[model samples]
Target: MNHFFRYFVVGGFSLLVLSCGTAGDKAQAETVTERVENVKVSPLKTLQIDREINVSTTLEGYETVNIAPSVTGNIEHIYVEVGARVNAGDLLVRMDQNQLTTTKLTLANLSHDFERVKALSETGTVSQQAYDQAKLAYEQTRESVDFLSANTFVKAPIRGVISAKNYEDGELYSGTPILTLTQTHQLKALVSIPESYVPFIKAGMTLEVTSDIYPDVRFPALIEMVYPTIDASTHTFQAKLKIPNGDNRLRPGMYARTSIKVGEVNAIMVPYQAVLKLTGSNERYVFVVKNDSAKRVRISLGKRVDDMVEVFSEELAIGDQLVTVGQARLVEGVKLNIVK
Candidate 1:
């Protein structure tokens, strides 16, 4: 009888322990069932947004010219130095004028001989061939003088500032330029655009440009040229923009950001916070509530306005609930407890 009581008590304790373990597990499971994440969702809506393209490029002078005399000669004097502002027709350099002076004296002597030859020919004392020879010699000498005079006086072809002085006074000018002139009052920038935008971009289209040096200023730019051919390697076309820098504040080689409005696009607009970037990649995604569960949708982003951004995705539709808040904690197909 004592042995039976011991066995029965031991068995009863074992049964109680199993029952308590089962009850504890049931309670834990119930608690886990109540732990759904609370999120706030906004219904996606379609809106018309301005589609803009942004590209970075370096600024350039409107006109950049390397000024050099046509004929090779000794540079007698340099009238301008680096940073000197010059106008059109202003003499910038003077080559050796010894050749010019000698040619001019020869022309003068030929003129007198030609006059005497003409007088003789009119009186039949000199032959017509003699008069023709004198005239040709005089004309040829005069042409040489004119050509020498032009090369001796090197003038600025455009109104601009001298950016470089490659030669000094009493230096022999070979093939290199004497000076580098650049028009800085107006600037230009070449931007490469994707071939897809060729149809939308046209000459005279206005764009907004900003430089890193002057961050707050927005200079107005106009599309001055559109290249006819697209680069086969890059699959992009080039566009030249004219930016007015009347104050001479902007300089060439400065970094610039250009923004152009291609047109309007219809896109699904969502709060900027709703988008999340995937770790270790440039891929972006968003979580939307579908039938009380979070659904992850990959999206391609477009232009962002104020607090909203444009997203493109075939998986998302108008009126779909997007989780703007509490998206970080959610995962694919996780149960959602949406709150206001």
Candidate 2:
């Protein structure tokens, strides 16, 4: 009876030990399976960005007039220099007036003689021929006197400054400009628009004009005029606009940029790394992934700002998963593994 009892206890102990071991093994297997299933990677997705365009242009003033000498004489005094400001009718140069003064005195004597002859003819004290000769002489002398006044001083016709000093004091001014005058109160920017944009460009249309001299600066201007004919050499039409220079900050011959706001709105874009460029049609492409799978999608491209490019594609929906990195390892219909 004692032996049978001991054998029963030992058998019970062995069974209990086997049962605990099996339970522990099952728990460990479950833990391992859970960890393996948690390890997963997915493709990164980026939002869409808008587009922009850039073109080169120059800045110019609305009007530019050259100061030309009006009469022939020696330039006696130059009152202004390059970059000096002047008002309309301001004295620009002076000439020797000796000849002019003498001509005026001679004309005064001829006028006295003509008046006396007219009085005598009216009283029948002189012949008609005598009065006619005096009248003709008086008219010629008046012309001579008028010509002398213009030869004395070269004055500014417009409110401008001396742009160039071609002569100095005591120099000859023979109806030729001793200096160049330019008015910069307003500036005109001329832009050549491509023939494709002819329909959109017209007089009074507003556009933006900028200058590098004042970085990031822009002003409002209108399409003051447009050429009716297109330039065959460049296949573009010329457009002009007026820009105000109230502070005289913008000078003629200074470089400028003109920006035309064509369009603006929201869009989807991707990093440049995600886009693939090709020849022939200038088409761009990007890669999209879903459900551990990726495919190369052909996409149209638009304006790019910085590192991002506008993805122009109907196939690419907003918030679509894309392969930003590890694109080289991806292909059409290829399997993918999320890295992060």
Candidate 3:
């Protein structure tokens, strides 16, 4: 009976030990099976990306004109000064009136003589040749008088600000420009874009320009012209942008930076943190979390704008969850616990 009792006790202890080992194995297996890494994920989205080129530039006047008298005379009256605004056909200066008065008197005498001779010719009292001579002289004198009168009042050719004024009242006009006018209602922005971007640049493309002078203002401009040829040395092409400055807020000499949208493409954009560079190869990749598993997808990178980067991959789809944070510790097919 003692031997039987001892054997029964040993079997019972062995059975208990075996049960404990089995339970421990099951727990270990469960722990391994349930292992997962917490990661922050963001859904990949489709974005319309505009490829752009940024260039520094300076603003210029839309149109510049020099105002000068067509005839030689002494300036009698000055109507504008530097920085004065004028419109087309507005009188800017007046020439001496003595020349105009003399021409008018001569023209009046010639007109009276021509009419008397014309009436005589109609009455058959004067020769046709004499009448022709009087008419020609009168026409010539009238033209000369009209020319003198028109030049007496120097007018603005364009609507703009008088940027320069050289002569004043009583100044002799020696065929020199009296004033310089620049159109400020519209401005021009000259930007040099890379030659590679020349093909994509077209007229009417929108440009966003910013200036240090107006820190809070972003001036909108349109691509007005694209030069036909590129600069051989710089490998760059020049593009002209028209900026509307009807308020005259933007000056011609102001320094500016321009952003031109050269082209556009549909791409998958993700946070900067999601893209990773491989340790050895030059390949870039991102982790896509699908069905509780991490998938490694190789991608081609395009333009980067701020914190977002454009990625192209055949395996990536819009709305797919991508591991943005905690992806460094992940491998392909690894289980994921998506967190915020």
Candidate 4:
């Protein structure tokens, strides 16, 4: 009878323990089901925004010329100084005239001999071979004289300001240029634009440029040229812009910022807070509520408007609920209790 009593007690205790364990597990399951993250969301919408391409570059001269003589000689005179403005056809420098005078005298003597040889050949007094030799000599001397005259007087090829003067008067002409002339009436800016913008850019389009030195000024510019091919390494193409600097206020090598308005674009814009950066990477993403669960979507970002930024993604669509608030506390596929 004692043995039976002990057995009954052991069986009862085992049943009680099992019953308590089952109830605890049920309570724990309920707690987990109630744990829903509270978040605020905004519906995605398309906004019309101005599409602009902005690039920074340096201003350069419209035309630059290095004035130097073709022949090596003593520089007899330098008519222009640094910062001097010159017009086309203006005499810039004069080389030594002694060589030119000697060549001209030789040419005169050759002309006389050639004329005498031609008359003798016609009269049968000289052979045809002698006449030919005389004619060749005269022609050669005349060409030499002409070349000397041109090189002796160096003239300005274009209207520009003398930016540099390398040699002084009576200096021997070496390989270096005598003067550096730059056209300052207009300026050009070469900017590298991404290949994607090539379709929108074309020759003769108008653009706007600004300089930090002239913060209040907006210089008008026109597209002069667009490179036909893109750089494979950089995935960009070059564009040339011509800016009118009639006042001569803008100088070469000045820092400039250029803006080109291709056209307007319809973009999906969301609150800036909705965008989040992936940890340890530059990739950006945003979360949206999908079937009461948080769904992470990767995005490419564009220009930022006031309190909002442009976002692009294949998974995003208009009227989708985007999480703007309480996103930091949620993870992928987490149940969300949306709040107003």
Question: How many clashes in each structure?
Answer: 0, 15, 0, 0
Query: Per-residue lDDT for 335 in model 4?
Result: 84
Error of 1 at 48 (Å): 2.8
* TM-score, per-candidate, Cα-based: 0.64, 0.58, 0.60, 0.70
The TM-score, computed over Cα atoms with residue i paired to residue i, of candidate 2 is: 0.58
Candidate 1 scores a C-alpha RMSD against the true structure in Å of: 13.5
- Candidate 2 C-alpha lDDT tens digits along 48-154: 43322344566665655666655676777888889898888887767787887888888999999999999999999999999999999999988877766665766
Error of 1 at 20 (Å): 56
Worst 10 residues of 4 by lDDT: 26-35
What is the alpha-carbon RMSD of candidate 4 to the true structure?
A: 11.6
TM-score of 1: 0.64
Q: Which candidate model has the greater TM-score, 1 or 2?
A: 1
Tell me the deviation in Å of residue 333 in model 2: 31
**171: Cα error in model 3, Å:** 2.5
- How high is the lDDT of residue 93 in model 2? 68
Candidate 1 C-alpha lDDT tens digits along 170-285 = 99999899899999889999999877567789999998899888889999999999999999977689999999988988898899999999888777889988899999987889
Stretches of candidate 2 above 4 Å error? 1-55, 121-133, 173-176, 261-340
Q: Could you report the Cα RMSD, in angstroms, for every candidate shown?
A: 13.5, 22.8, 20.6, 11.6
Tens digit of lDDT per residue, candidate 4, span 162-215?
Answer: 999999999999979999999888999899987756678999999889999999
Model 1, residue 15: distance off in Å is: 64
